[model samples]
Target: MTKPANTQLTDARRGDARADRTTFLWTAAFIFAGMTVTILSAATELQRANSAFPVGKVVLYEITGFLSFLAMFPLIAWLVTRSTPGQHSWRQVIPVHLAASLGVVILHVSLFVLLRKALVPVFFGEPYFFTDNLARDFIYEYRKSVLAYGIVLFAITFGRELEQKRRELAAAREDAKKSHRLTLKCGGRSIFVDASDVIWAKSASNYVEVKTPGAEHLARATLASIERQLGDAGANAVRVHRSWIVNADYISRIEPTGEGDLKIEMKDGATVPGSRRYRGNLNLS
Candidate 1:
């Protein structure tokens, strides 16, 4: 018995989110540490200018400095997904990438804030946007350095996340190859169904209807477990609605009607749904 690809992805996401929390936490910690270092360095620089600026003041500056970057996390993640990861893993990649990228952005911003302060000690550059300090001068100068730093961080973050996605994709392919094969008897005839042959599967109480190129076969199983077993066979075996799995391969056309309901026509002329809730995964712009 095999599950649909989308279901497996959903399960994978849930499992990965749960299990990979440690990885996420570690990544966050690493970024946070980077930010702390930057803030400390900035404080040291600021201290050179105004020795009266307390250590506690530096901490406060670092905390507030990271605010803009932390707020932009969601936007950055969405941009990355639409720009890169979406193509390889479908929309499933969005949530995982978002979760990971959010952590990264927070880290990036924290570091930026820390470093923003430390510029003076590290590079002897000016710190403020609109004031000539006792040390260095000019608001315009601050703009140039901030922009340069932001560009560099953005590039690095994009590249790092893209690399992570590439690795994840390879792992998914390998997992799919290992788990997506099946042999069954349909109408007294033996048929071998490759993962790709399946357009989707439907559940009928105890038995699941495995729809393939030739015909649909009734297998006694649960769709939930079958979905997991399918692994990365293909995410197109999407859960169009709760009861049906639509194979992405067979999705010939989609038509939008009123009230957020969609009419989808498959290659087999079998019509399914385009419910607003799950449609985002089906055809994402």
Candidate 2:
């Protein structure tokens, strides 16, 4: 079943927080693995060129990739928080994400280029040259930047969705624990009932009359209040009038009143007056 709107918001918030934590933990790993691979490649190329101390070149590339990724990760995380992977809304999410993608690419490329120009010579013992072509460097780096951003998107969205699923599973388990029984405190006493056995309830001035096929129990609460409590417990009972409620499971007949109201007949020959205002809530057969 679909979650309630407020519940969905609460879950989404919890998921977002979880994603943030996941992102932080994973980002460190991401930077480390990324640094290792890129540095290894740089070492291999410099060694092939017979350059001494290829370690400096390796350090330069490692720092560049790491810094660029760091700059863009938060933006990607924010984007994924609002709209996870495969989930979009009517709020122009696509356009906003597109803009974010461009921003990530641009930030990564710009920062990398600036750091390369400044630090390559002092550290790597070589001049930083993009084959003497700025445009070519930008284009080449843009390709990798886009790829990196895509990976970040996948990571952040996947993490949030996984966390969301885990929370929902946990909630389901908790609900299961409480499924068979519910306790109501009223009249200075505690009354326990089998959730499934509850057939209907009605307003009784300052108290509520809860009925099962076997017996009736009175609780010191308003009908409106109990209806909300029952609804929260996933009860099938619904308010049929200002003063009455009926259980969907016990409904056997719906007799339409000429005044556009309804007379809900129960399986036990009991009836409740259903107002026209509440008729829309009924799923009469």
Please list the residue runs of candidate 1 whose C-alpha ends up more than 4 Å from where it truly belongs after superposition: 1-179, 183-192
| Every model's TM-score | 0.35, 0.53
Q: Model 1, residue 127: what's the lDDT?
A: 61
> What lDDT does candidate 1 reach at residue 275?
76
Clashes of each: 10, 0
C-alpha root-mean-square deviation, candidate 1 = 17.1
Candidate 1, residues 157-181: lDDT per residue as tens digits?
4455445444444554565667565
Model 1 vs. true fold: TM: 0.35
Worst 10 residues of 2 by lDDT: 168-177
The numbered model that scores best in TM-score is 2
Worst 10 residues of 1 by lDDT: 134-143
Q: lDDT score of model 1?
A: 0.58
Candidate 2 C-alpha lDDT tens digits along 1-285: 568999989877877777777876787687788788878887888879998866866687778878777877777887876665577773766677777877777787778778898888787677877457877877787787777777777877778767865664455334434664445545767676766677778888888888877888888766765665566567787788989887788888899887889988888778889999888788864
lDDT of each model, Cα atoms only? 0.58, 0.74
